[model samples]
Target: MARFEEIGTATIPGDGTRLRLLQRNDEFSIKVAGTTGELMNSRLHGSEDALATLACDRIASQPEARVLIGGLGMGFTLAAALSALPQDARVTVAELVPEVEAWNRGPLGSAAGYPLHDARASVHIGDVAELLREGKGSWDAILLDVDNGPEGMTRKENNWLYSPAGISAAQRSLSSDGVLAYWSAGPEHAFTERLRRAGLSVEPVTVRALRPGKGARHVIWLAW
Candidate 1:
């Protein structure tokens, strides 16, 4: 077996948790120092892409659609959104960890085709929740693949994102007919109910982590 080589490490800004980047042969993965396990893997990003694709497909006809992406993990979601959206569409990617963004621009860029360099994509090194609060009725679609589904695995603050208040903020951030998408490791019925309570219709989709019917099942919630 080929040993995994440690590429680099970064500290999560607020909690001081260390995130280690590792590469095994041609594959790359991100893992936290503590109990949360692997954050993401370069080879498994089907659900992430689906999160953006499903939402972008819904709003593809909207002229000059503005999309907000929460989390820039592996840039799969951003790349998929750019591919699905029209030339006039714009995408804003909010990444909490600065090192993650650096990784995407450096070692991991090729894995997702260097999405950050795209003219229509903008990278924000901050919390997506804050961005949602500030951008009122600004986004045509909001795709959130942050922190292992609706549950917060990396940061405690992420819990607010799935809460009633957070769902409300996400709802307000979208334009009428806009969609809000969420990616999770598994299903969360309570989270689905919360979205309904926020006045948005919800659709739960189970997608494989890899294409062609391979890998574990992941869930994507589409709300509008």
Candidate 2:
């Protein structure tokens, strides 16, 4: 077995939790200490890309579309969105941890094709919830892969992102035909119901972790 080498570590702002960046040969992974374990693996990003592709595909025809992406895991979601969106479109990524953004620029940048440097993409080093609250009907689509799922792993505050109040905030942040997408490690029936109760139609999708159909199954919820 190939031994994983610890390349770097960053302390998550606010909560002080530690995130460790590990690598084995060409593969990279982000693991949260004392929490949800491995947050993401570079080799397994199919679902993450799907999270963006699924939502962006729905609004691809809209010119000058605006997209808000929560979490910057390995930049897979951001990279996928950039590929699917037009040159006039814009993408804003709100990452709760500053280190995560830095890692994307340093270690993980090549794996995701240096998406942060794209002209259409911008990164905000803050909670996505705050961005959602401040923006009103300002986005054509919102993609969330923050935490492990609706339930948070590193930060307790992330729980609100999947709560009823969080759903309402996300709804207000979207345009009339905007879609809100979520990526989860597993199914969350309760979370789907919450979206439905919030007055948005929900579409649940299951995708593989690796492209070409491999790895564990992940779920994505598209609500509008």
Candidate 3:
């Protein structure tokens, strides 16, 4: 096992605290200042691989369709979605943290091969919540990996995106038969109900990053 090396450090704007990024080959982690919230390599909870799989599976059916991916997180989800879709598909990724996006297009791009910079990709440096509130439709698929899950990893305010109003906004942003998939660290029955209540046909898919070698399972909520 390789050890993590410090890549770069930055302080969250407005917030006085700082955070450091670490990398061990293709795996990466983040250490939050004055906090124990150190995200480990694409496993042990903050698994970017799992997020990618969940997002990709939901948009596999729509060729030449428009897809919106919330959160760039390591660019895993965006890259995976691009790989699953046809050449004609377009992916719009909305990321709140500009630094994360820069890290990917720079040092971390090698891990995922700079997929977000691909011709089919459009990067939105903004909040996913605001995007939802804009009432933009015509998207064939919308993948939300914004928080650690619907329950959130870092911010409690993210919980609103899992709320009834947020889900409704997501539904409105989708095409008639469009799919909406959310990646959560754990299951949330209330969120599932919210999806259905928002008029989407919902299904829960359980998956793992490693077939037999890895521990723990993650659930993906697929709503269409």
For each candidate, give its TM-score against the true structure: 0.96, 0.96, 0.86
The runs of at least 3 residues in candidate 2 whose Cα sits more than 4 Å from the true structure, single-residue gaps closed, are: 34-36
- Pitting candidate 1 against candidate 2, the one with the higher lDDT is 2
- Total backbone collisions for each predicted model: 1, 0, 0
The total number of steric clashes, by the backbone 3 Å criterion, in model 2 comes to 0
* lDDT minimum window of 10 residues, candidate 2: 32-41
lDDT of 1 by residue, 95-197 (tens): 9889889999998888899999999999999999998887589899999888887778888899888998888888888898899999999999999988888
Relative to the true structure, candidate 1 reaches a TM of: 0.96
Candidate 2 local lDDT, 1-224, one digit each (tens): 89888888888778888888989987898897765557888989999999999999999899899999999979999999999999999999999788788888987798999999999999998889998887589999999988889888778888988999899999999999999999999999999999999999999999999974788999999999
CA lDDT of each prediction against the hidden true structure: 0.89, 0.91, 0.75
Per-candidate Cα RMSD to the true structure, in Å, reads: 1.3, 1.4, 2.7
How do these models rank on lDDT, best leading?
Answer: 2, 1, 3
Error of 3 at 43 (Å): 6.0
Please identify which of the two predictions, 2 or 3, would achieve the higher TM-score against the true structure.
2
Error of 2 at 70 (Å): 0.4
Reference-based TM-score, model 3: 0.86
User: Tens digits of per-residue lDDT for model 3 on 96-148?
Assistant: 76787888888877666788779999889878888888877878888887767
